[model samples]
Target: MGFRNFRFQIVVRVLLLVATVFVFFKIGFNATLVSTQIFVGLLISGQTVALIVFMERTTNRLIKFLNTIKYDDFTEVFTSRGEGEKFDELYKSYNEVIKKFKDIRSEKEATTHYFQAVVQHIGIGILTFKKSGEVQLMNNAAKCLLQVPRLEQIEHLRAVSPQLVEQLLTLPAGQSAVLKLPHGKERVPVSLYAVDLVLRGEDFRLVSIQNIQRELEDKEMEAWQNLIRVLTHEIMNSVTPIASLAGSVAADVQDYLEAQPGTQICLEREETEDMGLALQTIEKRSQGLVRFVNDFRSLARVPTPKKQLFSVEEMLKQLQLLFQEEVAHENILFIVNCRPASLTVLADRELLEQVLINLVRNAIHALADQPNKTLQLEAFQDEDSRTVLQVSDNGTGISEEAQEQIFLPFYTTKPTGSGIGLSLSKQIMRLHKGSLSVSSELSKGTTFTLRF
Candidate 1:
C-alpha cells in the first residue's frame, strides 16, 4: 500500500484501541485503569514488531538494488510495487542512472573493438605510443616493416632513433613523421602519425606508424612508365631517320663505286669501308631499340598465376648455368650454397627463374668496380619454414640516396644500365606470393634477400 493509505490504517487501529480502553474504564474505576494500560502496551508492542519488519525489508531491497547494478545485472529493478510513492520515485531514478552507466560501458566496449579491428586489418603498418613514449598499439604490418621480430627490439628502438624521440617530444595533439629503422646494416622507412588521446581524463599523445614504401614504389613506377613512353617516341624519331639516312648514304657510295670501278683509288676503297662501318653502327643501335621494345613488352605482360611446387635451390643452380657465359667472361667467381637440398616453394617456374637471374645480374653489376669481385648465393629454409635465397656482393654498397629508388624502373647508376632489372624482379616475387628486399651499407656491401 502507499504511504498515505498505510498511515490511515494505523490511525484507525490506534483509535479503535483507545475506544476499547475508554469502554473498559466505564465498567469499573480500578479495572478501567488496568485495562487501559494493558491495551496501550499491546498496541505499542505490535507497532514495534511491524516497524522492525518494515525496516528489514527496506534494507534488503536497497541492498538487492545496489547489487544488481554492481554486478551489471540490468533487468528491471522494481520490487514491492505498492509502497511509499516517494520511495517508488526514488527507485525509478536509480534505475535510470544505472541504465546510463550501462550504455556508456557498452559504447566504450564497441569503440575499443572497432579500433582494434581497424588497426589489424589495415594494409599499412601502425604503431601507437603515448607522449611519454610508452607503446600503446602495434599491428602486424608495423612489426614486419620495422623488422621487429621480437618485443625486445621494439622496446630498444624507442630509445635508439632520435627522429622517433623528437616526434614524441614535439608531437602536437596530432602530428606525424617518417622514421628510418636500422636493420642489420641498413635502414627501412616508416611513416608515423601521432594524435592526442584522452584516457581517464588525461591527455596522451597517440603515435601511429605506417609503411609508405609501397606507395612510393607505385608513384615511381607511374612516373617511369610515362617517361618510357615519351623516350621511346623521341628515340624512335631519331633512330628511324638515322637508319634510313645511313642506308641511303651506303647505297649512294656503292653506286658511285660501281659507276667508276676502274677510276676509283685505293683511298676511295678505304672511304667506302669507313662508310660501311658507320652503317654497321646504325644497325647496332636499331637492334638495341628493338631489344628495348621487347623488354618493355615483357613488363606489361602480367601472366595469370600458375603455381607449382618447385625447389628454390634447383632454380638457383639452373640460373648459375644460364648466366655461366657472362660470368665467365666477366671473370666473376660464382658460388651457390643451397642446403637442406629440397626446399620446395609454390611458384611459377619461369617467373621465379627470371627473378633469380635478375637479382644475380644486379649483384654482378654492383661488383664491377670492386678489387676482389665475388658474389655469394645462399639458399636455405628459414626458421619460419619459408624458402630463403640471398644474393650478396663485397662491392661498394648502395648510397642512401640511391637506396630509395633502387627498385624503380629506369633508376640506374650505371652509364649503360637500363634500370628495369630490379623493378621487374620485385614484381616477379610479388606475383609468386613472395617478397624481394635488400639491406645495405655504403662502403661495406649490399645484400638482396628473397623469401617465399
Candidate 2:
C-alpha cells in the first residue's frame, strides 16, 4: 500500500528510524562498522523527507477545499485517488456537504424567481427604494402607472406627478395617502401604502400603489342613486296629496259658483267648514314637507372635523355624567370598562362626543320597554393592536338587512328618526383615519366599535 494508506505509511517510517537507531548502537559497540552506519543514516533522512512531503500535500488539499467553499465553487470535484485512506474519507464527506449546499442554493434561487414573477404580475404597482431615493426594484405595473419604461430613482415619478414624489419620499411607514395625478387632460386618484424593511443591513421602503378613481366613482354614484330614491319618495308623498286636494277644491268651488249663478257665491255652513279644514290640513302638510327638506339640507352640510388629542377614559366619564339621570330614570344598568386608563386618541373630541351621545341615546330608546336593560362602554386594544372604543347594549338588536343600510344617509328605523346620525358618525371616523363598525344579534344585543 506504500504511503497511500496513512497507517501503513506511519509504520514504515517508524521501522526505518528504529533501524537507524540500531545501526548507531552497533557502531558504538564495534570499531569498523562506519559504512553500514552511514547507509542507515541515509535511509533515516530519506524517510523523514517523505513524511514531510506527505504532510505538505495534506495541507495543500485542505487549503484547496477551504478556497472552494469560500468562493462557492461547487463545480470543483474532490477526488480520493492516490491520497491516504484518511484523506479519502475526508474528501468524500466534503463532496457530500458541497452537494447539499449546492442543492440548497438552487432551491433558494428557484423560490426567489417565483416570488419575482408574482411581484411583477400583480395588478397593484410595487416599488422598493433606498432612503436616498435610489430605486432597487420596479415592477411592470409601476412602469405602466408611471408611463415610464424604467425607473432608477424616485424623482423620476415627478413626470407623472410631483406631488406623488413628495408623498412617496416623506410619508411615514405604515401610513397611506391619496394623491391626484394628472393623466392626459384628467386626473386619476392614486392610493399609496408604504412599509419599511431592512435588507442586508440597509434600510428600504416598499410601497404599493393603486388607482382608486374607479372605486370612488362607483361608490359616489351608488350614494347618489340612494339619495335620489329617498328624495323622490318624500316628494311624491307630499306632491301627490297636494295635487289631488287642489283639484278637488277647484271643482267644489266651481260647482258652488254655478249653483249661485253670480260672482258673490254663498256656501252652506258644512261646506264652508269642510273647505276650512282642507286648507288647514294642506298647510300642515306643506310645513312638514318644508321641515323634511331642511333636515336633508342639514345632513348635507356637516362641517369638517377639527381634531385634537384627548384621553378616552375622561371622555367616558363625562358621557356617564351627562346620561346619569336618563339611565337612572330608565332603571338601566350602566357599566364603563377601560383598560390602561391613560389611553389617548387623536380625533375631534367634540364630534366624537356627539357620535357617542347619539349611540347611547339610541341604546336607551331601544331598551325603553325591555327588562334587564344593560349598557356597556369599553376601551381596549383589539387583536390587531388597534385602540378600540366600544358601546354595547343588551336590548333589541338590528336585523341583518337593516344593518347593511344603517350607514346610508337618511336611513332610520326609529319612528321619529332623521337617519343622519350613523352616517355622520361614519364620516367623522373616516376623517380621523379610523373606522366605525357594528355587530349585533337579533333579540340579544348590539355592539358598536370604533377603531383607531
TM-score of each: 0.50, 0.81
Deviation of model 2 at 269, angstroms: 3.0
Query: Per-residue lDDT for 144 in model 2?
Result: 73
Task: Encode model 1's per-residue lDDT on 1-452: one tens digit a residue.
Answer: 43445456456656665665566555455654886667666766676567667557667777887887788877756644566566677678878877887898899999999989988788777666554556667777766765665442234666557566666557665556666777568776677776676788765655566666678789889887867765676477659877787878868777777877897434467776877777777888887777767766776676865889887777878888888898888888888888888667788888777777777877888887877778888888888788888998877889878888787665677777776788788888888768999898986789999998
Query: Model 2 over residues 227-255: C-alpha lDDT tens digits?
Result: 99988877888878977887888899888
Poorest stretch of ten by lDDT in candidate 1: 146-155
Model 1, position 337: C-alpha lDDT score: 88
Error of 1 at 164 (Å): 38
Off by over 4 Å in 2: 1-4, 13-49, 84-93, 130-134, 152-175, 182-186, 196-204, 254-261, 309-346, 376-389
Global lDDT of each candidate? 0.73, 0.87
State which candidate has the highest TM-score: 2
| lDDT assessment of candidate 2 | 0.87
